[model samples]
Target: MNISRRALCGVALLAAVNPLGIHALASPSAPKIRVGVLKFGTVNWELDTIKHNKFDAANGIEVEVVYFAGEDATNVAMLAGDLDVIVSDWLWVSRQRSEGEDLTLAPYSTAVGAIMVKNVSPIRGIPDLVGKKIGVAGGSLDKSWLLIQGLARRDHGIDLGKEGDVVFGAPPLLSEKALSGELDAVLNFWHFCARLEANGFRRLIGADDAAKALGASGPVSALGYVFREKWADENPDAAMSFVKASAQAKKLLDESDAEWRRLAPVVRAEGGELEVLRDRYREGIPKRPLAEEERDAAKLYEILAELGGEKLVGEARQMAPGTFWAALKT
Candidate 1:
């Protein structure tokens, strides 16, 4: 397999502005942190790399990981007292809080999602989606897709709740149906999106552009690190340590090219063309969480509350007063 020019350019761009520091791996520590994550994507890569390379260990921390195929599985495990940390979407935290589900926004992970449709589908834009059937990965915490739909509803005065106007399904079905021309669109996470595109599905719109249209100031992040409320309350020190360690990993990628290349595949796996996946990794992942971006999360919550026909926005206290660990510095 050969790398794309865009991927090559992406690698070069990342090398020029490496803000996440990639230092020498740290030594192993005891009582490893247990984290449950979605399987075999960029996020899985990050968690696995951190565990295998002893990135947490180097910082005097230990990490244990569990993998699941879907966000619902991770949420179910978290609710069952089986996980210390889980990687999920930010909007999910808000919706969960609004519904009185117990969880907290631990940290921002990544800000991207993708919309896939048959390469020849008539759906060319958001407005084109009226009366069309679309699929979403059921129980996916990646609410950016829903957020985009909500924004479209608000801005265009359209209603998706009406029968036959919109439909939702899991990622596998989304892929299968779209390929078979049974769907107008499918919303999926990053790596899945890349694979779908490679399979000839055209991207109708992406979270990045959707966020902007909805008035987001900077790039929007979707996935976040979340911890159960009880677990966090009992393990504040561990929580802080976890936050700091993850931030350090982000910093490593921000600063070191050699480190980014080594870690990029952990996010996006390429069969043989490592460069293409590496390029996608560099451009797609956010180096670290930003506090200022919490406003977007807040805004997303407000939108969901309205769409969900709720009275009050969920508690802000649930989200860490500081969005990212480093933000607490000021």
Candidate 2:
């Protein structure tokens, strides 16, 4: 996840058109907006739906969906101006803003993650995770991991990083390790956690549950759509259009299981995997953006800042004002 500038430059040099045959670059005659995305994330499904349904064309813009392997690649692309927008955590957006980068975030999904264990395991709750081998998806600095650390410290007076043998790996590998008994529990991203649940794993605690224990008023979404302030200022209509289109896609996802079935091929999900993803998507789809004044948002920020330390959000303990794009409120 530590992407040096030179490495990013190399990636840019080697970047190619999307292999899926979706347009890699927008037409010059139209407003061209390049969006960086991960092939397996929820934004991938939403963007694919938009493209397949001609939503961008209907909105008077040409969107080139650029695929990235991870957040590092996407961050590099966006900073290099190869991408106009990206779906990322609000914490990243806040960090960028702290460094004087003009970034704004809008809600994507409020789906928080979960701690999953085998159904037969003796681990019944967060307290039981003490002295356990827990597999973490993503690095030690991951927001969810940080939040869980905070939860552990507050709820049971235990420092999870000190008490538990935490192994960091990719979601798939974490799932594999947890299922095979190599790890006692796995703190995974929502999608993989859903898959584990579908395979009969039981959730010890979800993100929302942890957040509430740490004093959040309601659910908090870690992911959102991030864009540069200058770009939004210059292309106001395009920005609004993109948000509207994404909102439409979210609505479709929220309203119809049939839509999930239709999108399975596009999302590259199959059989029971498709059903699992559908359920996860339904659980994650945000009803609306989190309000800046809400207690939930404030408490969530506090937890992240306190637990994540300087590694996550720079030296700032508070989220930069205007980090949330209020234009989307309309």
lDDT of 1: 0.60
lDDT of 1 by residue, 94-154 (tens): 5566566667665544536677787877778777777788777643234555567676776
Clashes of each: 20, 0
Question: How much lDDT does each candidate structure score?
Answer: 0.60, 0.76
User: What's the lDDT of the predicted structure labeled candidate 2?
Assistant: 0.76
Candidate closest to the true structure, highest lDDT: 2
Model 1 residue 181 CA deviation (Å) reads 3.0
| Model 1 TM-score, 2 decimals | 0.70
In terms of TM-score, the best-performing candidate is: 2
TM-score of each: 0.70, 0.87
Candidate 2 on 127-231: residue-level lDDT in tens? 788889999887898777777788778867889898898889988888988888899999998888878887879888887787777776656667888999898
- Candidate 2: residue 306 lDDT (0-100): 77
